[model samples]
Target: MTSDDVRHRREAGHFVRWALAQKIARDLSFPAVRWNGPSQAMDDEARWATARRLLHDDTLKSEDR
Candidate 1:
């Protein structure tokens, strides 16, 4: 593989890890807010699922910023 390919892969990996951390932070909901809404739990789950799927998707590797 070319160096650009490797660099892209590494950047994608970094973004994936950052997304994972964000997922955790969102899931925790440390400061319980009144506007969280009834769908907060589902939203958090969906966010994590989407992040996980994108992180592992070969198609998304090229698309990650």
Candidate 2:
């Protein structure tokens, strides 16, 4: 493969990783505003727990991402 293809592949991989993370975060819970603060997302522990449950990695296309 060409260098351009390699670069695009890496970029797409990064996007998939991020998108999956966001998807998991959303699946975990909706952000809630604290009594006197801004809205907060699921805790780190929750996030990691979600990550641990994943069985495989998805290699998505740029459009899919």
- What TM-score goes with each of the models? 0.29, 0.27
> Candidate 2's residue-wise lDDT over 9-61, tens digit each?
54555555676687843433222323664367879897786565553335544
Off by over 4 Å in 2: 1-7, 24-65
Give the TM-score (vs. native) of candidate 1.
0.29
lDDT of 1: 0.57
**C-alpha lDDT of all candidate models, in order:** 0.57, 0.53
lDDT of 2 at 32: 30
Superposed Cα deviation of residue 33, candidate 1 (Å): 33
lDDT value, residue 58 of candidate 1: 80
Q: RMSD for each model, in Å, please?
A: 15.1, 17.7
Residues 2-31 of candidate 1 have per-residue lDDT tens digits of 354454554555555676687843432222
Give lDDT: candidate 2, residue 24.
Answer: 49
